[model samples]
Structures are given as C-alpha cells and as structure tokens.
Target: MITKTFKSESTIQTLQLVQQELGADAIVVSMREVPAGPIWNPWKKSAVEVVAVSPNDEPQVRKPQPPMQMPPSLEVAEEIPEIEWDIPAKKKTAKLPPPIKLNLNPLSGQPAPVTETVRMTEPTAPSNDRYSPPALKKIQQQLTQQGVESSLIERLMELSAETLSPSTLADVEASKRSIVQLMGAELRVQKGAGAFVSNNVVAVVGASGSGKTSVIAKLALFFRQGLHKSVTWVCADTVRTGAIAEAKAYTSALGLDLKLVYTPQDLKEVFNGEQANDLFLVDTPGYNPCNEKQMIELGALISEMPSRCTYLVAPATTKEADLHQLSASLGVFNIDGLIITKLDETYTFGGIYNFARKSNTPLAYFTSGRETSRNLETADPMRLVSALFGKEWNK
Candidate 1:
C-alpha cells in the first residue's frame, strides 16, 4: 500500500491536500495537531498533520483462460518401398607425417621424431551423495532443533520436499540452509532506532514487565548517540510505582528534556510544547492483557493522539499463547510495530519469529538485557534467521 503525510494550517486543508495528492480512494490513517516549532516555544503556532494510504502501485495479476477446442482433421501420408543398389567402398589409408632426412645418416630417411602429445583433463566438481535420506524427516528434525513449532515444521518440511529432489537434499548442510532462508524470506522489518529521531511521536506500550520504560530509555540513548539527535522523554505512567522515576533518571543523565503527563490532555500539551525535540519517546504503563479495564485505559491515552507510531513491547521469554494474546488484547491501541525485549533472557526465538507471522506484526527492535540504555538492536531478518539456525552465516 502507498502512504503519505500532509501538514497544513487546519485538518480540512491537510486532508484536502492528502486527497489531492493520493487520489479519491486514498485512506486516512492519522490526523493530529502539532507544534510549529519546539513545544516550549511560546511563539510557535499549532499545525495539523495528516497521514494517508492508498492501494499499492503494483498491477494485479489476471488469471489465464482455458484454450478453445478445435475440430480434428485427418490426413494420410504415402510411403514407397525401399530398394538396394550396388555400393562403392573406399580404401583405408594411414595418416602419417611426411618423412624427414636423418642427421646421423644423410642417405637414410626417418620420420620426424614420433610426436609426443599430452592430453588435458578437466577439473572435477566436489562430489556429493547421489541421493539423500528421506527429505521430510530430515528437515523436520533440523527445524525442531531450531525450536520451530511442530505443526509449522511439518508443513515447511512438506513444502521443502515438493520443491527439492532427493539429490538436492543429499548435501544436508546446503539443503537445510536453503530451507531456513526460505523461512525468513518474507520477514517484515521496520527501520528501528533510525526511525526514532525523525518520527514526531512514538509510544512504547506492552504488558507489565514487558520493558516499556527500558525500551524508551534504550531508544533515547540510540537517538542521542547513534543518530546524533536530541530526545524528549515523556512519562504517562504516573500510576505505576517507580515508572516515572526510572524514566526521569535516564533522561536527566543524558541532559535531555523530560515531561510527565497524567492524562491525554497533558500529553497533547507536551507534544505541542516540545517541538524542539527531534524525537519523543513516551513511556506507558504496562497492563494485564486479561484485564479489560486496564486495556481500555491504555488504549484511551493513545487513541487521543491523531498520529503516532505505537510500538508494542513483549518479553522474548513469554509463551506463544501469551504473545498472541498480548497483541490481540492491545490491538485497539493501533499498534504499528513490535519491540521484543529480554532477548538475552531466552535462547529460542522461534516463538517470536512464529508469533510475528501469526499476528502479522512488523518487527521493530530487540533488547537483550536489563541495562536501561544498552543492548538495543534493530529487529533484522538475517539476525533472526541466524539466531534461529544457530550460525552466523549470511547475517
């Protein structure tokens, strides 16, 4: 799909520009009021920002129609009998070089010293087993070793067998690697740390203990050092003990701006005042996805904002069911990407990989430890595949 943003003096003007640029079928994704300058700059006026989307530019594929049948016509060919006639035969002759005179005896004639010829041989390819063991069983074992679910493993192995021949699977290493690559071929990843500095607003949300505050801090550090930009830290988790304090400490140490918002109105005001900041990392209170009241509270705060990239953080150590439920419970918050936390806490990331596909969530970033501002890395396809396959190849 196609997406674009338009900013203007008012919502109507911004939308008019969006519809004009994107087309009549374009969809409105987000609309919000933003500051004309740094949020704290009193002279700056308020402006509106609008985001839109349209169908992808790709051409749709049309199915082919069956060919029409035609009437059959019969034809006959004539043949003639074969006859034999006298054939002439050719005499065989020896192929030899002209005779040369011998140096030792002037009268004697000798053929040139029998020519010595050397034959060249071609280089040989490395030999492989002519045939492999059963393809499905072998692949299933490898996928299990990588921690992929049993059901997915079975389906993948069957697809592998259909695409590959026994001889292709004979080279176990090459065959397995190809299958793993296929598994990661469609992994969708968003520009993680880099996007922080440029995006106007970003809210980090997830279940309690999912590391929302830590992720915000990590992103702040990345924005400051990695991207060489200033950051504004906002804490909307006033009800959570130690949440504001933890975020305050990180922002103070970095000499960045810190703001506290107890309500959506407070956040809107902060966004208007903090215009000078390159990025805004908002810390949200973690909730129990099973608690409907808590989920509504969390979703309410974000829904007030017109345009924000919402990141749902989840622990890497969590179970498949919990991950899916966490995403589903908070889906109302308009989640844009996923940030997987506590990678150092778990070795098997197959569930994370599998969950992304099952939920259709775009992976954002990964945190490896409890360190407030370190161990943050982008969610990369190669890295996920390398971690799963237990090797560093092609990462």
Candidate 2:
C-alpha cells in the first residue's frame, strides 16, 4: 500500500493536502505538531505533520512455489573445473585528522589552547547503554553531575546523537564541543550593564541572602570604574536585617551617594530629580515567594519605577524547582534580565540554564568570589557551558 506525509501550518491545511494527495478516502495514520521555521529561530510556531494513505490501495500477495524433487544420491566429481576471475583493486581513501579539543576555562576570559587530547590507544569503546556511543555517555554524566535537570540532559544527549555523525560521535572531544554549542545556542545573554545604564534606573530583587546587596555593589563599581558613569545607590530593602547597613558600607567604600526609601512614595521622590546621565541602581527587600502580602508590597515598589530595567537575582546553588518558583513569583515585575550570584560557592550551574530556558529572560551578569569589584562578570554563555562540563567558574 502507498502512503504519503503532509505538513502545513494548520491542521485544516494539512488535511486538505492529505486529501489532495491521497484522494477522499484517505486514512490518517498519524498527526502531530512539529517545530517550524529555520533552526535558529527558537520562537518559531509549530506546524502540523500528517501521515496518510489511500483506502483504495491494497497489499500485493505472493503466490506459493511448488517443491522440486531432488536426486536421491549426490554425485561427487573426481575432477573439479578450475575457474579464474579478475577482481577490481580496492580504492584507498585518505584518513582525516582528528578534531581539536577545546578547553573550557572561565577564569581566563579568553580562548585557551587545548590542554588535553585523546590518545588513539585509549579510544572510547562503543556501549549498549541508553546514552551510548561512550562519548555521548560521558557528556550525559558530566551534565548530570553538574546538577542539570535529568530531562534536559536527556534532550541534550538526543540532540548530540542526532547532530553528530558516527565518526564525530566516536571522538569524545568532538561530541563535547557539539553538546556545548547546542547549550550555548539556547542561552541568551543581554548587552553589558553599561548598555542598559541608559535606561536610567536599574533594579535588583531576590530572596533574602541571595547576595542582592553584593551584586549592587559590584554593579556600582562596574558603572563607576568600568563605564565611568555616576551611580546612585537606592535602598528600598527595609525588610531584611542589616540590609540597610550593608548597602551603606558598600556605598561608603565606593564614594557614592545612598538614598533610603521606605515606601513607594519615597522611592518616587528619590527618582523625581534624577540626573539624565547618572545611573540609579535600586536594591529591593528580599521576600518569601510563598508570602502573598510581601510579594504585593514588593511589586508595588517596582511599579514606582516605570522605566527601570529590573533584574531577578538568583543564586547558582538554587534547585530547579525553587528557581522556577522564584522566577514565577517575581514574573509580575516583567523581569528584564537575570543576575546569577554565588557562583564561587557551587560547582554546578545547569539550573541557571534551565531557569533561563523556562523564563526566556536574558542573563545580565554573574557574580563570584568575595571581592566586589573583580567578581562581577558580564554574562558569558561559554562560562555557563564550561561549568556544565565540570569546569567551575573560578573567577
């Protein structure tokens, strides 16, 4: 029987195509929605794929063959005829060079030379494991060890298996690069803080102890020292203990003015006479995601700054579910970017990638180490990718 597949933007259109190709009495074997558009466009709409066949088509049957009678006694010839045949010579193909290994170092902030290579004598053997072709199995294990969600790791393995050729899959280094590139493509890093400083007001909010205050200090130095812009520290975090004192200490060291605001009106007054060129970095109070009252109050303060570029500060050590809950709780603020903190404390960072994927928020910066000025780094996709492969973000 003959069958055909049809794809269209809509189910109705797919049905029409099936009918056109297979006639009115067509039977649909399967129908499903598949991603459409170019590979680079992740936000592309889905299209319907339908497999159909005509009902009139019938399977061809084969007739049975009659058995032939065989001689009772087998005849053995004393002399066998000698036959000579000419066989063509086999063509020799040139061997291709192995792919270069890439080192993922987050501290260098530059591409480093490959420090390791796969020795031919120690080649990875193929396996019957679920995430097989040993190279891909290694990739899966690395991702899992880095605390990446199991579902995402499986998806990455599938992508690696699908995109890499058998020869490439045999090479662990090539498979590693392919998997890293796949993750890097999904990560979205926004322009540096200097670019967003033009928005005039920058705000950061998070749960208590998420290093929100430290991130603010780092941003202050980044704008003042790095970008050469005047920065005003606004403290709206009245809920957290010592939050005000911490903000003051950071501001005092940076030689920047600090504005203390307890209410939305106070925050409004602080921004009423803001300078056009000066960057205002606002620090918000930490609130529990489960506390509706605190969330409402926090949202009210954020509403005061109509032109603010808000960032949701998340610790790298946060679990996937908690990260999702935090983002969902603060999603009402229309989070413009994400700031990942506490990178120095944890080794795994796959949760960050998962959060970015779910929220569709671009990462702004990543903070690590104890030093404020040197710790803040503009979000780098390769850095996160490096961490997923057991390379910690050292700097």
Candidate 3:
C-alpha cells in the first residue's frame, strides 16, 4: 500500500501524473482547495490537493503438482527395548524441610524477594471492602472542608469508577484549574463612579441578538445618572427594525442627545458637530455573520469611529459553533474587547471559556441580570472559575 499527496491547479494534469505513476490503480482519498500565489492572475486562484492510495503489487501464484505413489516394504518390525518402568516412580515420599521463619527485628540481616520492589512501585488494587459509597462520601466531605465546592465533589463522585479513578481524578482537577487560569476572572462592574465619565466615548458591535441595545441603554443610564456625564447617543444601526428608535427612546427619557446616522459620512458629520462635553456612545447594527455585505458595511462604519469597538457577546444563547463563526466574521473589524451578556440564564461556563480561548479576546464587562448600568461589572477570573465549578461565592 502506498499513499501520496499531489498539488496541481489542473485536475487533468494531476490525474494523468497519478495514473502514470501508480499504473491506474490509484484511488483518490480526498481533495482540498488551497491558496496559491497572487490573485491578479486567474491561473493563480487556488490549487486542488489530491491524496491518493495505490496497491500495485500482485499476489504470487504457485503451480499445481501431481502426487507420487509409495513403494511397499515387507520387513517385520524388531521388538523395541523394554524401558525400565517403575509405577509412580516407586511412590517417593521424601520428607519436606520445615518452613523457615524470618526474624522481625531490623537488625536481622536477611534479603527480601525481588517481588517486594515490584509491589512498592506498582499501584495496589483496592480491597473489596474499600469500595463503599460512604467512604467516597467521607472523602468528598474532606475535599469540601479543604475549600473545594461540594457540587464539584459530588459530580466527581457520580462519575464512573473508570472515569473517576484516582489517577484520572487528579488529571481532571488539574485540567479544570488550568482552564480556569486561562479564562481568568468573572466580569465585575467598573469601579469608581467617575471612571465611566473619563472615557465616555463608547462603541458597541456584535452579532444579532447579543443585547447590544440593552447594554447601550444600561450604559446610558449609568453615565447620565451615575457618573453625571453629558451623554449623546449615536445610532448607526440602519439595518435592524426599531434599532434607532429603541436607542433614541431610551436616551430621550434620560434627556440625552440621540443622533441617527445612515452612512459613515453622516457619522463623521454628527461627531464633528457634537458638543465636546457630551460623551458619544455609538450603537451599530447587529449583523448576521453569514451576510458578507452587512459585515462589510458595518466594518466600514466601525472603522470610521474614533473610539475602539467593544464586541458584545451573549453567552447564554450562543452555541459553540455559532460563537466561533461569529468571531471569524467579526474579525474583519478590530475587536478591542468583549462584553458578555445574559449570564443569568446559563449555567455552563464552557462557552465563555471556549469563546475567550478561540477569539483571544479579553472580557471587558459581564451582565448577570437585567439590572441598570450598576449591574454590569468588569470581568473577574476568580468569580468565573468559582461559578463554573458551581462554587458559592460572596455576591
């Protein structure tokens, strides 16, 4: 059996070469598109990579042969020697030596069996009496006393014996801790009431249904009331229904200025004429990742903004594949940080971990409940780690 991979822009050329080399017995295993050189030339667009397996060696065939007839011998067989035979070897009953006992004192110079070394190195099997649920519960209680959460302990206990073997349990815990370390912390509300006012210019961008509008409203209240910053809400979200009106209504109730911009030029004009004292918060349209036109349009608008883009993510409703796809599509825009919303709805923190890991984006804020701006917090790794393992923490 032979396997080979070939790359060629022309399918005919690749197939001809493969057939010539493998004697037409080659089977194509797979084909994949790969980037080639400059795109200015149509010939350099891409290449097809073909993987093939060939079996050219033939099995050896043997020639059939005729059997021969045997000649007869007429000699009488000679009597075989009568070997000495003792029934049951005369039933030997030799006296066995008495068992030797070793001295218990350490001073006794006696060598131990090599099996002792193996026993010391190899893992010992658990005794039948040691496989008690109560014993496991006691161990769980001890781990809880040492600050491990009871829920995690119980989950570990519920795992099958093979899954939760002593060695495997240690490995699982170590992996969990490593994941927590990488994810860092849970998002916490920004400290210092005046900090929100210092950086009043904000931009929110993310996939559809990620709660950007709700987050923008919460921030509006936070800055207008909590930080006492003059707020001007700008809407660049022309694609979604009720997006501009929703933002306008929310900001209007707080006596904040709301400007609706249809294009990047409109945005520049509005920002240029805006009051210096007012903090401008731009709301972008929620984009479907699959819509390349929308993404390109939104990217252009975001690029025009003076402030960096803060991507909003809804962890509770986001599936792993969707999150990854969303991240890839949004990568066109320079995503500065992330804001995770709808944390109150989901218990699994794996999505959060996976998102942060895949995107390499730092968590900026997290919204646990549908509270006003005060409920949003800066991300804290410890809180997230505790929450992921179902550990109770001081709220």
The 0-to-1 C-alpha lDDT of every candidate, in the order given, reads 0.69, 0.77, 0.61
lDDT of 2 by residue, 1-395 (tens): 57778998876556556544555445566556778999899799878877766656752222222222236796533222122333446755433233222221212333222132322456688885564788988878888877677887888787778877999999998888888888888878776554546487999999978988888888988888877778999999976788788888889988999999999999999977767678899999988999999989998898999998899999988888998999888888888888999888877677777888767889889888768778788887778887877776773
Identify the runs in model 2 with alpha carbons over 4 angstroms from their true place. 1-131, 192-198
- Compose the digit string of candidate 3's lDDT tens values, residues 1-395: 77777776655445444554553445665545667788686776666666666665641222222222234765534232122323466685543222212111111233211110111246798775535344455545544544443454555556433344465344645444543453354233334323543344688877888888788877777666766668788888877888867776787666777888898899888767556667788888888889979878887887777564455565545876788888787776666667778877766655665566556776666676665545676666566655656663225
Q: State which candidate has the highest lDDT.
A: 2
Q: Over all chains combined, what TM-score does candidate 3 have? A: 0.52
Error of 2 at 238 (Å): 2.6
Name the better of 2 and 3 by TM-score.
2
Ranking by lDDT: 2, 1, 3
TM-score of each: 0.61, 0.65, 0.52
Listed per model in order, the count of residue pairs whose N, CA or C atoms clash below 3 Å is 6, 0, 14
Whole-model lDDT, candidate 2?
A: 0.77
